[model samples]
Target: SRHAQFAKPHSLWLNDPDSEQDTDEDDSDEVEQIDQDEIFDLIRSISDPEHRSMTLEQLAVVSAPQITFNSKVPDRVTVEFTPTVPHCGMSTFIGLSIRVRLLRSLPERYKIDIRVKPGSHESEHALNKQLNDKERVAAALENPALLEVLEQCLSTAGRST
Candidate 1:
C-alpha cells in the first residue's frame, strides 16, 4: 500500500491532477525563510568593532540581508546592503560593518563580495577594507583605562593652550 501510494501520481491529489490547484501558493514566503544554519552562517560572517560578543545584526545595523545562490559561482556570494540613513556620516562605518560581517560568516571555501546599492549611503569600495580594521579600533576603545588617559591628556592640552 505504501509503495502503491508513492507510485500512483494521481493518488496524492484526488482532483485536478495536473492543475495548479495542487501547487503551493506561498512560494515567496517559502523563499524568504532562511534556515537556522544559514542564519548562523550569515551571522558568523560579521564582527562588531564596538563590542565583544556583539554583531552588526545584534547592533541593529543590518536590515534584511538577502542571499542568492548561483550555479556558476558556487563559492562566491554577492551581498547587497541598505543603510539606516541617507546622509549619515556612519554610512562608511556601517558598510564596512556589513562587509566584515559577511567575511566572518562564510567559510574559506566561499568568498564574499559586498555591494551597497545606489541611493543608499557609502558608494565607495574602500569601505570594505575599512570594515576589517574595526576589530582593532574596537579593541582599543574597549580598554577601560583609555578614557581616563584621554581625559588627562585633554586636560594637559587645555592647560597648555
Candidate 2:
C-alpha cells in the first residue's frame, strides 16, 4: 500500500476539464514548473546501499522530506534516514550516497543537509554536522584521486583475502 503511494506519479495538475479551463495559460505554465521538492522526491527513489533493488522508501530509510529556498539564505534541503541497526558503520556511507544523489539530481544552487533520524544509537546532531561540513567533504567528493582510492579498496574487498 505504501509502496504504491510512493510509486504514484505526482502530476503537475490533476486533470479536471473545468479547472483547466478556468486557469490562465501563464498560471498553468507556472504550475507545471518543477521545484526542489519534486527534485528531492526523485532522488529519494534511489535505493539503499545494502539493499540492491528496493528503494529507500521501500526500505523505510527516508522520513519527511523538506526543501527551502530563499533569496536571503542559501537553499537547504533536509532528509531523515534510519539505519538497519544502531551500530552500522555503513550508515554514514549510505547518507553520503543519498547526498550525492541529491546533488547530482538537483541544480547546483542547493545546499543539502542530511541527518539520521532521532531515536537511533548515533547522535543526529553530530551526523548532521558531519554532513554539513562542505569544505572537508567537498575535497574528497571533488578529487578524482580519492575516488580511485575508494574504487581500489572496493575491488580489493571483493576478492578473497
Candidate 3:
C-alpha cells in the first residue's frame, strides 16, 4: 500500500553474510524520504513558452538542486528555477508551470514556493512575487490566453487538465 502511494519504492532489505538475521519489526521496512529528484521529474517536461521545441530541463532552467523540501517542516516545498537567459521574458510563465505541476502532483498539505533562482534573472524579486502571489496566480489562470499557454506547456508533460 505504501508502494502504491509513493512514486518510487519505499523499502529496502539487505542480508549480512556472518550476522544473525534481524528479526526486529522496526528494521522490517523504512520509507524513503521525498527528495528533489521526485520534484524534478514532476516539472522537467514542461515546455518553454518561447522555445516550444525545448523542455525546461533541456534549457537548464529547472534543476534538482534548486528544489528543496524542508525536513523539519514536511509541508513546505521550495523550487527555484533559472531562465535560459537573464533577460528571458517568460520567467513568470516558467515559474507558473512549476507551480502548477507541483499543485497537481503534490499533496494538499504542501505549501509550494516557486521563485526565480537568485542572480539568474533581471527581475527576480518581482517575478517571484508575481509567481507566488495567490491573487495574481488565480487571476492569471483565469485568463483564457494564459491558460492556453499553460495547457500547451503542460500537455507535452502529460499532465494538462
Superposed Cα deviation of residue 41, candidate 3 (Å): 0.5
Instruction: Using TM-score, give the best candidate's number.
Output: 3
lDDT of 2 by residue, 11-84 (tens): 11111111111111111111334465564554445544444445565666664454444447545656667766
**What is the clash count for each candidate, in the order shown?**
6, 0, 0
lDDT of each: 0.39, 0.49, 0.68
* lDDT of each residue in 3-111, candidate 1, tens digit only: 1221233211111112111211111111333443353344432433323244445545443544444459666665555544444444443443344334433455655
Error of 1 at 36 (Å): 10
For model 3 the TM-score comes to 0.75
* TM-score (C-alpha, index-matched) for candidate 1: 0.41
As for candidate 3, its clashing pairs are none
Compare candidates 2 and 3 on lDDT and give the better one: 3
Worst 10 residues of 2 by lDDT: 19-28
Q: Tell how far residue 15 is off in model 3, in angstroms.
A: 59
Give the lDDT of residue 5 in candidate 2: 22
TM-score ranking from best to worst? 3, 2, 1
Query: For candidate 3, lDDT tens digit of each residue in 1-161?
Result: 12122122211111112212222111112224557777687788788766767888888888889998788996698899887778776677778878876777666677899988889888888888888888877776675555666666676663321
